[model samples]
Target: MDNEGVFVTKRSIKWLATLALSASLPAAASTCGDQGVWLQVLGSGGPEVGDQRASSSYLIWHNGKARILVDFGSGALLRFEEAQAKIEDLSAVAFTHFHVDHSGDFPALVKASFFSPRTAPLPVLGPSGNHLLPSTEQFVTRLFNESSGVWPYLSDHLSGNGAYPLIPHELASNSTQPTTVWEGVSAKLSGVGVNHGPLPAIAWRADIGGKSIVFSGDMSGRSGTLEKLAQHADLLVAHNAVPESARGVARRLHMPPSVIGTIANAASVTEVVISHRMLRTLERKEETERFIRDSYKGLVHFANDLNCFAVP
Candidate 1:
């Protein structure tokens, strides 16, 4: 019963797990094709300090192109570039909420992509309005509007120019089911609002070439919407911002590890990727893992920034 001298090595287990995953990936090419799909963790940190991690962000890649960009928090832009994702190739940009930690890098992405030769309309999608933060369309206008936005020049360049038009798709959800927010050549995005205290947030799920990946944006576990959105997903990227014993304000805004398992189990996801790790959860990772493991039996990983998982 001695729990002493137990050496905990960071990244070892996840490294091996991902290595085995990579072997199943389709033969070398930029495009994933039907043989594979993958996720690139841009930022795995939460709102506050998280060692070297950036805030919540993720990318879904297929056929050598970044098909979807989810969230754009602090430090995410750098990580996005480091991952070599071309904005021109992105089918859409989805935000879980308007919180800075989840949607801060929008202007940067727009500015960066403006320079690219991309002429297609870029879809930006998020939950419906809440008084707590600006609505998705308002968020885009406030940052890129001609007169009031931060980058007025982008008003013409980012939109209405027939080039690099950033189209905002604000989901005014009146139902609990996952609604399709975007559809493209090989990707389809669906979203449903989730409980996040007073903030309007949503969980997103992407079906690419018949494979699915769901992102459980910041949530309080009060709503059953997450389970519906994540149903039968190939990977479930749930936030591990708190532990089983989380209380007070934190518990009101985020779901701990056990709740994550419950949702993952209910949804029947093929894998569980625990992200948005805060200091509290990182310090007790073993305990967090155990809590989730108790409820969900699937491929689970404590994701690190830039980690890639080739979807099976």
Candidate 2:
């Protein structure tokens, strides 16, 4: 290995030791409470499964209430249950795009919400469709509409007093800037498009209790648009799907650690939490941290399944 690789490996060993020590400590009380907003990572892995991390799903709790669910990837439904988060309390569900790894569990979540006792409509937000891609409205319609969908059984049930209604909103594709998706309970939601293959991907930003947190759905590379949308955010949740060494191929579908770091740095975010890891990223955790630390001079964390962080 080269000098940089060797340094990274050494750092990895140190971090692994630290992680071991941290795990040995008694389980702390669930930090989520009425005073602060807490973010629980339901799934931190990518599409692959070698590392045992679940795919992308996040539970954002504001004032001790589950307020939003960002992304619903594979294995997320079970992870959500494991986290013991209430789907009924969610004010909105936002999708970065239509990619399977980022949205595979959506149908399951909707089905579960149908059985919950939520009396209000759950708003769904996603990217607008182009000629090549279906809009968020079309996507939901293709799944839950009455005439032609597998979940048509839900159509009648979701409308009457017995069922939970779903309100879907398709974000404009050509929006000049960030646009609001939902607002309530001292929370405001907005989104912006980012690079993620041909699919029209969106990055969501939520403001709660005067703090801002941005989730960069799946981006193809570092995005100025994302930086603008995430400016001065207290936390930036970015996808760390590949290592810096795999930059060449990863640039087409996901962001490398260095690119993510640059975006976090440019956005002036106070903390960067890297999620969406695959086997390659899991194996080179130190390398990813080192690359990010090189550009971002802020708190950086590698997200794991069931990991929780608080917005102070």
Residue-by-residue lDDT tens digits, candidate 1, 1-312? 011111233646754554455344333222223336788888989878636789999998887788898999999999988888898888888998888888888788888876888988888998777667888888888898888998898897545874768888988633478899889888889999888888888888899977999999899888889898888888898998888998999899999888988888999998778788888777776677667766875767777788777776
In candidate 1, which residue ranges exceed 4 Å CA deviation?
A: 1-35, 157-159
TM agreement with the true structure for every prediction: 0.88, 0.87
Best by TM-score: 1
Off by over 4 Å in 2: 1-31, 157-162, 174-176, 247-249
Model 1 residue 52 lDDT score? 78
Q: After superposition, how far is residue 250 of candidate 1 from its true place, in Å?
A: 0.8
Evaluate all candidate structures by whole-model CA lDDT and list the values in order: 0.80, 0.77
Model 2, position 53: C-alpha lDDT score: 73
- Report residue 242 deviation for candidate 1 (angstroms): 0.9
How many residue pairs clash in all the candidates, one count each?
5, 1
